[model samples]
Target chain A: MRNIIIPAVLFILVITFVALNLFYITDNASRLDAILVSASDAAKNGDFEEATAEVERFKEEFSAVGKYLFAVIQHNEVDDVIFSSNRLLALCNADTKEQFLSEIEVTRESIKLIRDAEIPYLENIL
Target chain B: MAVAVIRTVILYIIIVFAVRVTGKRQIGQLSPTELVITLMLSELAVLPMEDMQKPLLAGVIPIFVLVIVEFFVSAVVLKSIRLRRILNGRPMPIIENGRINQQNMKKIKLSLDELAEELRILGSYDIETVSEAVMETNGQMSIVLKEDYEPLCKDNMKAKKEERKVPAVVISDGEIQKEGLLKAGIDKEQLKSILQKNGCSSAKEVFYMTSKAKNSYFIVKKEKKQ
Candidate 1:
């Protein structure tokens, strides 16, 4: 039993490390997903300029998500609008600091919708 | 702060137990139902953590209600087929016999482009290659491949595997799984049924009906062939 404990401990340590890494990566991925999703929403609502900038910000923040999320999100028919808006929250930032101090205010509202909509869709992925 | 800590601890326990009751689905996999459940659970799980003023009872009561609701719905589904149909909805046939069901698609508001896109995500490139497609209750699409696209048999569209040999169980250590006996795909129920099709009839006669990942259900009967 004592002999078993060492490898078990090491094994657990390894698993915990991997699990933590996965959690970190997942957090990053979800954030990026939110950003790209918001951008897609903007694009859909005929805010191409906002969408473009959101995507650029997302790409800067989470490269992997920025790279792949657009194609995937576009392919999926978002059944719930709030979920789409939540994804937008992940990507939301001021278009310009001067022109949009109100971006944060808009984002606060979007965050509410995003949480309401996005939280439902997110259960399986996490 | 002490209550906050206590609440967090309690929240974790409740969430974990609820998830366990709900099934391995929280951590394991995502069918449509599981996905929806996960979504609802997560949002709700946050409430207990956030509500500092409300007693833990407030958080716990709703969870109890959810489980009760789940149990009630499940019982209703188990007892009544019509109620099941009304609550869960039937599998919508998105495609049937190699043709898209345009009427069904319109009812679900699914477009042809959307269908193709969903299929592509599932690795089926061409709609013509689909035998059938079903939109399952939890909002996931399942598709049956056309004969040509299926990775089995002498037709040989793909050289993946010819077929698999599944083993029939005669005795599991000493007893038998009766359902395992029939699933060996053998017919003994009626004289009118077809002859010599993958045959088996006894449980005390089988060792175990299992196949390798790519083998047929090979039955090891109690008595050896002469």
Candidate 2:
């Protein structure tokens, strides 16, 4: 039991840090997500200014950060998604799955982000 | 153009987080059950983000739900060893002491051909090269390479009287590596003195540094243009 104390403590501490970091990133992303939803909502309602402001917020937040090869590409990707998404938001009935899929193509775009931001990092780590 | 892009960007963050939290099992190491769950989770996350008509809460809620379920399961697993084994499953020994457990392999529905392929991909050639292979809960095959297959470490790489020591990062970028200083059996003052003699006024001037059994290493940043 005594031999295991420090290892156990350190393990707990390490796990806690990882968990908290995940939580922090999730919380921040979700906050940005709320703004994103509102941006589409505004675009739907013909509120271009509001939609633009929503996107601008994300640009400002991520533009300077995560410049590592992975970060850079993924950040730009989100930039593209939000940019095109604004178009559909402005469409009266264009927010339908067909319109949204055609304009935003969220899944295909997500692969890019995953490939750029997370996959390479994972590959390196492995 | 940007607003729509940012929304997708923001949503990916959550999805990625969920992936990360789901652990490294997503990459090539997944049991059938685990793989299905992973796909289900991804689809669940994507649904809300793509369909604006879907509730705004849809995008974020399932993630929290999964996390809560994980936490609850973890708590139960912690309290009951048997329950832990049941939920998280046990590590089945597929290859025990250089012998394959055919029953275990069949139980997991892994064909011999598939097993051999996976083994070879991970660098194990034969039973001799595989001391053991354990099927992990996440469905990853953990192979402990046999003694001969294991790579030669620095200690073994060197001959007699050429003892090796692990290299340590003494500094990174323009900062004094305080922990590294202590780790290397040196002090800040000594590092600083070395920096000064090297024409660097401060630790900030040093861009990179490393140390080994021999002694120390330092790298100064390029001078700025006047």
Query: What docking class should model 2 receive?
Result: incorrect
DockQ scores of the candidates: 0.01, 0.02
Which window of 10 residues has the lowest lDDT sum in candidate 1 chain A?
A117-126
lDDT by residue (B63-128, candidate 1, tens digit) is 767767666766767799898787777889999999889999999999999999989988899899
Instruction: Assess every candidate by TM-score.
Output: 0.42, 0.47
Give me the TM-scores of chain B across the candidates.
Answer: 0.60, 0.64
Instruction: Summarize candidate 2's per-residue lDDT along B1-226 as a digit string, tens digits.
Output: 1222334556678777766775565446764444655777778767754553355356567766775666566567679989867766898898988888999988889888888887887887776689889888866778998787888876687845665677667778776677778777778888777777778887777777777744556465656748
- Estimate the overall C-alpha local distance difference test score of candidate 1: 0.58
Candidate 2 chain B: worst-modelled 10 consecutive residues by lDDT: B1-10
lDDT of 2 at B168: 68
Give residue A60's error in model 1 in angstroms: 46
